[model samples]
Target: MRWWLTAAVFWTLLIMAVCWLPMPMFPIGTGGEHPKRFPHLDKAVHAGIFVVFGLLWLRVIPGPRRFLVVVAAGAALAAITECGQNLPIIGRDGELADGLFDVLGVFLAYPLATFLFRRVRDKQPVVSMTRA
Candidate 1:
């Protein structure tokens, strides 16, 4: 499969998963009232998107260029998702933390993807490109 296509699939699936199975509310030991909830499950959604997209990027684009494109796409998607959530029809609120989480996710996932790809490719042939 094409790398970008894989990324597209991953993004779609991740969103669907989050939408379909949202995190259940749990008390954060904040006493009888005004309980704070853990958001790890929510944050995981962003991390998952980044990790999957980064893997797709590593598979598709080679070298430093891969980082640039993948990060750009991830950032753009995060921004768009944040904005989209604000629409009345969406019945969602926008939060800066979500975007921040996405950025962190991309930062972590990209390096991990690169490392895994390299490890997987070790002792194997590297892709050769011909300049026109």
Candidate 2:
């Protein structure tokens, strides 16, 4: 539990840093200098990052309401990141599609994480303590 919480905090900060960083810091080919080999690659990256982000939060947050809270928080963070990108000083453009991809990533992560958790749980051996 402690490890999961620490991971969640670390990952969240990493995401925030990536979103707030300057455009030039990104890979050279990611921009208009050359035709993008994979035009939608950025969206895919956003989705992938949010998927991990949501899963990390889910691991730390307990209760039946965990899914709802995590998804909402992920979406809010996505929106805020997109808005931040629009700041003139940042010189980054905000796109609705990016936010949509972020939300989709979080939503998709729930089922994937649930499946993995169940698989691992089922494979674990039961242990019993006894006095000989």
**lDDT (10s digit) by residue, model 2, range 1-132:** 999999999998898888877787765524434235667777888999999998999989999999999999999999999999888766688799999999999999899989988998999998879867
Q: TM-score of each candidate? A: 0.66, 0.89
Off by over 4 Å in 1: 1-4, 7-40, 123-132
Q: What is the C-alpha local distance difference test score of each model? A: 0.64, 0.88
Regions more than 4 Å wrong, model 2: 29-36, 129-132
Point to the candidate with the largest TM-score: 2
RMSD of 1: 7.1
Name the weakest run of 10 consecutive residues (lDDT summed) in model 2: 27-36
Clashing residue pairs in candidate 2 are: none
